[model samples]
Target: MTKCEISIKMMNSTTPSPSLGYLTAHQLENLVKEHHRSGWKSLHMEEAFHLFNKMLTAKPKPSIFTFNLLLIAISRMRNKQHYPTLLSFFNQMHQAGGINTDTHTYNILIDCCCRMNQVNMGFCVFSGMLKRGWSPNTVTFNTLIRGLCSKVDITDAIHLFEIMPKVGCTPNLITYNTLIKGLCDSQNTSLALEWHKKMVAQGIQLKPDLITYSTIIDGLCKEGATEKALELVQEMIDKRIAPNVFTYNTIINGFCRKGDIQSAFKLFEEMNEISITPDIVTFNTIINGCCKVGSFDKVSQTFKEMLARGLTPSVFTYSSMIDALCKGGAMDKAYEIFQQMVDTGIEPDSITYTSLIHGHSILGQWKKAFELFKEMVDRGLAPNTITYTAIMSSLCKEGKSSEVI
Candidate 1:
């Protein structure tokens, strides 16, 4: 379909002026062209539908060719809400002397229905298409399977997938990816793996993308199978599939959670050596790992090293440092770093202030701690439960329970 046949315009309903008299198809074509050139493709479904209705109603006993334009117009809309509108529009067009529905028209409607989460309507369209002797294509089956997978009804998705070959419809990469993602989301890792294996066995020439590997790795990590996650990472490397930043971060985080700080550090170094530069998350994980083991000195040193490497420390980095310092009774130094944070153009967020408050309170500086609390409130920073707990405990230590309450 040409752009001229799919122009969309927004009508000004407030201006009730001269009625548009009878319009020929030629005039409608010209108007569509005029709108199309003026960036009509960017209009949303609502705006386009309103304009299209005006064009259709102007012509009495509009041709089925007019409905074809409407179909393409709705496809340009690319939104699910327009599916029913398209269906109703086509029905009305045929009732008003429109031509018979063709295979192309039904395919367009089915595709739109599937996209809009109305897979049942797509099925209805499919049945209609079949009754009219219109054969289903690969696009039709993929759309339905994808729609079912999107709703997480894996049973229906698998059933649709199985029937595709019966109808001579070959599943593509998108079909595999959609089903794989659904299985991964449902935590059916074994089935997801089986599907992946089947795809390979079929000589599908599959390229396991980052999402595919990450989903499996993350699932294994959550199931307390860190070894399996690591093994997958190694396998991805062996398969020449370079891991992305997220993949490295996931494994690093998993290692940290398992208290294997050494493994996490090794991965961090290996990531950089492989030209996968560490992001803020990578540094934060290692810093947090050191903090968990009460390795304050290592945490401080690592913070400096990260800064020296020109990595702008994020809020989490500073907060982790404050946490490690306070836990190690280095409140004075922690306060110094807190001041540097504000001076370095990185605005101290609530976490930054809370950590300093906790540090001062632990050092028996109740007045200083309270002043910081007031500053936090004045600066519009909300103190969380942890901040309140730290301050209250410090107050109780100074025999100021009544004042604290």
Candidate 2:
């Protein structure tokens, strides 16, 4: 049977099979307690289902807490594929009828629904929680808000944020952070800032954390307000919140996008001064920026520094360097870098291949360019418009204009 069919079957059948035998309520409780203490690190889905079945037959049945522990373990599993199974098991527990489901249990179900992208169902679960006379907590509101945000339903998310206080749930730092991030992600950075201002006004207890600063800084950067982002960085430091490598990378990328390589380099140096080790992303952004301005010397220097820091170069790292070398008319160096990338098990994407093709075409090496084009196609990479234009340009330069099509 398919997995879904099995889940349906499990949900409908609560009668304990005689062959599996039964455990006393104490034994089942101890088993769940042990797993809970371990943070469910080693609990497998099959073992969880087995425990649930055993619970069905245990004398006096396990308490709701024990059942919730098993459910929590399932939810915590790294593989999200089991989330549906968790919901199924919850249904089985509800249908069997004696255990009084608690607020925590409803929260878990609501979370599962939201994670599964069934935000409507999550709201239904919320309504059920209210009907059950269970008070929704901060986690409950946060999960629903995050779900709405994930769907880019910022209106509903904001509405929910406004109603939390009426429901006797005070919005916490996490709640504010989630809404801020949602607003920023939806390209409403201005409104996101308004919310940030509101968060700050809520008193010292609701002070913005590092995540809050970093997220808004990133949004500002994306909106081409690098200077404003820089000011916020200072504001954060003044508030005793140290910016991490990701924060620096975001601003550096913004400066690079604005074609202000000088400012990008300044941030790169500031990271060194602050003892925040530059990560691969930092080097890649610097290298790409340097490439754009034909600053090959800086590219070489930053790439060497990245390797010196024991960071393994990603495909993007190799691709940027290859493109830079190709554009600089250093075909020999570009070819060497391409080979090195392959030897390091980094596959060249269409951009990488297109760069090499264009480089060879510029050098009047039409034959070599065609060979790379064929290789790229054989590797299942589709030639984009730029790639086709490069080949046509090479053909036209070779006095083969008739073959341009």
Candidate 3:
């Protein structure tokens, strides 16, 4: 498993030149490292196999270092496409020589298996590692924990975490973060908080990172614990840990959901005081809240201010605006905004078209409603069943049921 003291020029991407003669074992290992560092997707992947084949053909043979690099490179592949290739190469390494698998080798195999969602295979490898006296490291356990959490198997994830200390795998911050994220994702914010407290108690000197704080705050917000979420925000401030845009957005969105726009505005102004420019999510949350309250005046003000700050409205923004106008019976104004939405290259979705059509129908402008229906289809937007029903309802009210047929 020692690195051979041999160097070879690495290619960003090039075929192995035959005229260069058979590459030494070090050259093959170096090439694998280069392919890995440069991104496997960007390299001539077949060349890696070719080089490995050539490597196995050389005298003194490619050592475990060569295959280890190759395995690491294969692990970096984006998806399941190269999984077979990875396993094939791993098997080939053992057959090429009587070289025994090392801890790193087992670790790589277990990690790759878990990544491919082959957790059973990963566990099999884990068992073999244990039987072979290869003590599992924190990385080994962390990978398993992450894979389990990804599958939302929180019971097993927590179970595995509890056994870490017993197995000499001290749960690191990353391990705690994984558990916290899993709890939050499962919407068990109360449990997430308990874990957070436990993590803090164990590592007082290790301050909670921003991601940890944000996850807890977002979980609380989603649970409608706006007041408690605010308390956490204050705690972050007191600890001299600045709340980023996500933190502010979470709290602000929670307040908005509670229809506490005044408090939402207060935080909005505070973000500016701290020089934290609001992102699209921030503005969308506020705009959506205003739409819920039928506060067109406030919605317009926020929309204008967002534009003044050079923030372009996302699809959420435009839909909120059009819906608010339609609700208020401002069909003409809504139509104007709808045109502007497309003029600015923001295509209206079904909600946008439905709002405009409903507004026209409410205003008794049946001609305009039919025109919008035609335009919607012309734009290649598939009108959902509700949109079709809205138009039918309008025609029905106007005694045009025969025309509808």
Candidate 4:
């Protein structure tokens, strides 16, 4: 018995002078009908099928509406703990004159299965939908596409997209967006852009929504195609699709990553001119860019501006600042900021510790650097290869070749 069943049985036993009878077939049908007519919010599966024997032996079997209603209730079930109840409910519904396998119905099941990460079951349902001679619609294709995409099956998703037209379902914007995101996530930026162009050539007007623009720009940045990313931003603007916060952040971060702090600051000024209020991510990107170029004064100014603009600095902000201070040979200042980070409740992680140790090692402060290294290990932070190499290189520069090995 399911937990719900056990709970219902326990509740029944605790009632005074409990009505000790199971629901008759007639009562079951009537209760199901009542629940269906009045919105299925209150139908308990345990009560509906208490007398499983009589329900299965009913003279005129339950209708399809009865089973579908049960399925909807099953879908509303939020917890996996109700899976047994649901499986039993589906089994009984199938046995009770319910054609429990249709395209729409299977789509719902596939969605639930995908959300639960039961990919095999979802595929099984898809096969069942095909074998039943039910033509899968665009919505069905979209659901499966999304499911495959969620599992990072970009190749399968693209295959499904290509097959949609053959299946008499033309791809829509949602389908394109799904496939584009999948391709972008896999760093297949060129292919993703090719599809975007195809989308436009097929007379699908490109609006360059946040996700669409962000994906392409991010892909270009990862490939160091910052110039192309900037051009696309202009293309989006020329197409009259207003750039949102994500769009600006992507461009700013791209410039920052390329160490082009001047262009990043220029974009910041442009953002303000466009009446786009900067968010914390915007500040973090500019601050990070300044830090990369060793422009501590500019970093400080941006940090102050970020605070004055009522934006809260995130962990990235603190990380970048600590990294910048350390890079500028200001270990004392870096440690002071590290203490302030703890004062403000931001816990330091491996990257933060690595930055400080790397700075001291570079300056030949072997004792201080090793102390931080031991402290890092004691605090359960494992230094990565970069941290080890930094220390080894420092020791080698001081002719400590034996220790370097």
Candidate No. with top TM-score:
2
Query: Candidate 4 regions off by >4 Å?
Result: 1-99, 113-121, 150-155, 204-210, 378-382, 388-405
List the pairs of residues colliding in candidate 2.
none
TM-score of each: 0.67, 0.89, 0.83, 0.74
What lDDT does each candidate get?
0.74, 0.87, 0.80, 0.73
Per-residue CA lDDT of model 2 for 306-361, tens digit only, reads 88889999989988888888877998899899999999898899999999999988
Cα lDDT for residue 362, model 3?
Answer: 78
lDDT of 1 by residue, 18-62 (tens): 434455766766655555566456555655565556655664534
| Candidate 4 per-residue lDDT over residues 1-405, each given as its tens digit | 001111111112123223325555567667667776777676554544443334455555554455555566666766565544555555544555634446666666666666666655667767767887888888778877887877788888888888998989877778888788878778888998998787767663544465677778888887878899888889888877788877888888888888888888888899999999889889988888888888999988998899898877777788888998888899889988888888878878888888988998879987677778778888999899978877776766777646633
Worst lDDT window (10 residues) for model 4?
A: 1-10
Worst 10 residues of 1 by lDDT: 1-10
Question: Of the pair 2 and 4, which is ahead by lDDT?
Answer: 2
TM-score of 4: 0.74
Misplaced by over 4 Å in model 2 are 1-21, 343-345, 361-366, 380-405
lDDT of 3 by residue, 1-405 (tens): 112221212223246655336778777667667766766666546666676677667776767776777777767764576765666666666666755678788888877877788776777777877997889988888888887877788998999898898988888888888888888888989999998888778766556778888999999998889888888888888878889999999999998898889889999999999999999999999999988888878888999999998998887789888888887898778778878888889878878888888877777777787788888888888888777887887787888756653
User: Could you give the candidate ranking by lDDT, starting with the highest?
Assistant: 2, 3, 1, 4
